[model samples]
Target: GIGDTIRVSLTEEPEFEIPVAKIIANRYNNRKQKHGIKAIEKNPLHPFEYSKRASKEVVGIGGKNAPIVVEHDFYFENTATDKLRITELAKWKTDADGFPLFTFTDFAKADKISTQANFVLMNLSDFDTNWQDVLAKSQNIVLVFESKTEHSMAEHRRMFIELINNDIDLPVIIKKRYSAISEEVFQIYAAADLGALFVDGLGDGIWIEHDEQISQQRMINTALGILQAARSRITKTDYISCPSCGRTLYNIQETTARIREKTGHLVGLKIGIMGCIVNGPGEMADADYGYVGAGFNKINLYKGKEVMLKGVPEENAVERLIDLIREHGDWVEPN
Candidate 1:
């Protein structure tokens, strides 16, 4: 279904050559007509507000904290890998016996669970009619899910929707396990699965379990990247650049590279690099700063929606944009 939607959005009609924007609009309108207004009214919480509320109910994950990136301890059991030492690895809290503090138990076995542990981990299937009694003794609950089918994202989303409908505000750690896949495939699969959840404000943390083939650092970085792309977290500089076209006035690729090279360390800053001003402002409406092509060898810089400098020479635009950032007290020294 999604593949068809994507294909239609990119392919031009043979007869009329309809705009991509209009095609998307028509598709959206058709869906609305099919589902009716009740579909829109059924959402219980706004996406932004949903995450805010979910964060508050969990301990150590409250006070408006960004969604955390959790590292699984799969490496600890493997003695062959010395790539990341135990001391340097990012891990969860452990008991004095070197065991995890929380207990991971199946839903069927939860009836005999003890309250000695502070945290309890359960699968989506653990949620049942008597779930309230089973979880009543725990200080915190962490829901975990793993898909058994190709529609993993949808299954994860449905689990979240069930929680919201039942008013279960426990923190959820979106966990996915991978093996026998290339690093590139893992990256795409993991991002598509977890990013879908986070973008809709569904997850409280992310936990990726993988074989030793994937480095520990790569997993950590992928988790952070997914959160950053979802706008749920900001751990690095964010660049919003358009694909250059006939309207472009300069080498957009080289310019974007130069801009990123200088400002890549400025965490939380959003920079938009546009080939032209036609759709630049509207496209990057949420960007904190913008560098748009104005005319031949000319540039325009904007702070928010307001243009701070107009018709700046292309040679001096990047530095001027940096200066503008400093003037606004948003610039920090690169470490």
Candidate 2:
């Protein structure tokens, strides 16, 4: 469940964080999935598959590229050791290269930014002459925005529109902060706040800031998952699952989880798990493959719009789906 971006935090020496971050980033980067318009030419509606979006290229950020992940925060005092540390880390495309070294600075301190800085996090309320001058001067630096408005989506959208209208093409990453809540609520908020921008092709990347009670790994997973749900990035296997109904022949939730447990490693794969034939095939046609309920404890497997197997026993449905996936060379051994 890793991606090209990562942030490592440690209570120990900063050097200790490097190996941990590098190991995870390298493991995922090695399997780096190239996502772009060509990747989702067939059915762009499938959220798990790459979808078409009009996004500008942000070097090491967006545009058919994997979503970049970052650690919580990086504070800099502009010391020689800090410079040495940033140099030692933050190298793009390498094992230790995923964390976007972010430092929060006002216009006054922006000039003292170490060369090791990859992104500068700033608030929109602070946008002034000095900020514009900073943005104008640094053409290559990526800027991440934090909004003070309650309606962050609209605020972020307005900010983006302002930037575009002003001819500021600097790559922008959307920063969102969330309080610890139920996973379901967090997911909903994330989709509306961050997913909307990604869908409209407005953001180069996303950073989710959450309460300390929420684990960092969960935050990373949720960040990547939001990108996947928007059809902006593909990291893990996608599940186009349906809410069960009266016609449902099997437990949609359990079946979907079971299938995901097995095939989740097959990155970019879309698996549709529907409760019945009513809206199952028609709705999930965008998926690469489907598992729809027939009746009387039976299931029907499909490849796109075409049914591949019929009347398979309910117990055998998941295995059959895996077999079908393997038959198509999409299966990978779970690690």
Candidate 3:
């Protein structure tokens, strides 16, 4: 059903390619029901976020997040007569009263624009203007940030702020398309109060590809990480368990996995597992419960040397950990 195509070769060469699709026609059941570029996306067992959504309209694959009940888009136009090219906002037009003239129709949206423009577009032709109209019509305008071909994005962002303080109707934000060196861009967008940030990094080419590994993971992690930072600031417990080393005298993997599996549902209780005694306790300093190999064929677990259980197979480790927590009433979340 995905019969979309894109012209691969520009000019007269006439090379065209089929657009990539999920290919499994019957795969998605809960997709946003609407077709075209704007579709409600789902991720299963994944907790991170993306770039494209710019607005959140569906819940993340992780059950922990709230549904993205709302979403929006930002559209820009090049209204300059000759399409001068400037990368800084300082070069844009100014009124007789010295008021800066930039493109965003809403001050809230203007704040979202970055103070710098690392990316550039040649004079956007009539066709480009129509394209912007298409995006605006197809997607709701949460904000609009304007730029002529000739202004530096950096200067534009500063001008946007200047406009806002000068009593402008704020768009949700103003931002340059996105660039490698725009930390200020991030700050402005974060301050815009957009509903959710869904990133579609696949479109950014060389700039994103240069740090593919990070760009790929960073998008989701950073969005969710903000929530994590807030959670950790006042949270109770965390756990870390290493895979069994070659020198592990006991079934450390099975034990660690089971322990984590059993206690994962518990909140505010830190647990650590070590394969050997050398670093087991030290490495688990933050844990309220710890299990480690005391010697060959000898294993030990203690709630502060209380010896909840010992000499158990890895399969039974989770049960033991659970029992220990129950015995001490440590598994309950603080009210």
Candidate 4:
């Protein structure tokens, strides 16, 4: 019985139930299906991993991990004149008969360059073969998420659940790409017990950030931060927040942002934001601590409270929330 893994938004914070299984890409399966080779015609014990997706394959010895003889491998080359350095590097290496073989990244723009070099020309589908391109196999998955819009979350979850309920027997693990070093991609990775995840650039994405210029140092540091984080623990605070609703009387967005900005350095604190008192407390039941917007313009601080605190100016909500968090408890390290 594979348990389902889900990407939950702290903003929406909706609870879902299902079993998770991670998906593994099978290179050996590619060899068998694409090249018509038996997974092991010659050998009996080759330590092959099998695809859990197909039931027919599961009945016996041949499947996804069976070693397939690879006819080609890709080498990347950047062909612009600015990439003269690449040519310089390739000059040191040679193909069969001691002739230099060049590589290219922009294969789409490689009409003239393809003629000039000895290279394997391939379509995008070649590298992206299903059950082949991925690095490893596992049944369970995790998804990294920041706040997604409400309708987006629902539709996304529904689509994902449908994908999960597919006939694939293998556990499929899902994870979000480009989580912050401050966020808990690693924790989620460990919690979901993932075998591998997609490595990526920082801050949602480099392209997601504005194309505006900044200091080289800042760019390098952020990039390094992302790279280092993909391989290390999240050394800062983990934050969760809610996107605001019309029921929101307070500045939910601003409040959530300030909490993230201020406490982001504090590791493993569980804070929550709810829009209105009607469903806020019930919805935020799993939160360690929370603030809900109450009717009559008051705020309900869920620090074991029965009555609510009167509304302060919206401008001061973040400050007051910070003060409240600091006053409520000290930060604890995640084990």
Best by lDDT: 1
Lowest-sum lDDT 10-residue window in model 2 = 35-44
Task: Write candidate 2's Cα lDDT for 296-320 as tens digits.
Answer: 7999999888999999999999999
Model 3: CA > 4 A from native: 1-237, 304-315, 332-335
- Local error of candidate 4 at 9, Å? 7.1
lDDT of 1 by residue, 258-318 (tens): 9999999999999999889998788889999999999899999999999999999999999
Q: Between prediction 1 and prediction 3, which has the larger TM-score?
A: 1
- How accurate locally, in lDDT, is each candidate? 0.67, 0.66, 0.37, 0.36
lDDT by residue (175-249, candidate 3, tens digit) is 223334234333223222121111211111111111222353443333333323223211234565654555577
| C-alpha RMSD (angstroms) for model 1 | 8.0
Better candidate number, 2 or 4, judged by TM-score: 2
What lDDT is obtained when candidate 3 is compared to the true structure?
0.37
**How many residue pairs clash in model 2?**
2
TM-score of each: 0.74, 0.70, 0.34, 0.33
* Backbone clash count for every predicted candidate, in the order shown: 0, 2, 49, 30
Leading candidate by TM-score: 1
Worst 10 residues of 1 by lDDT: 81-90
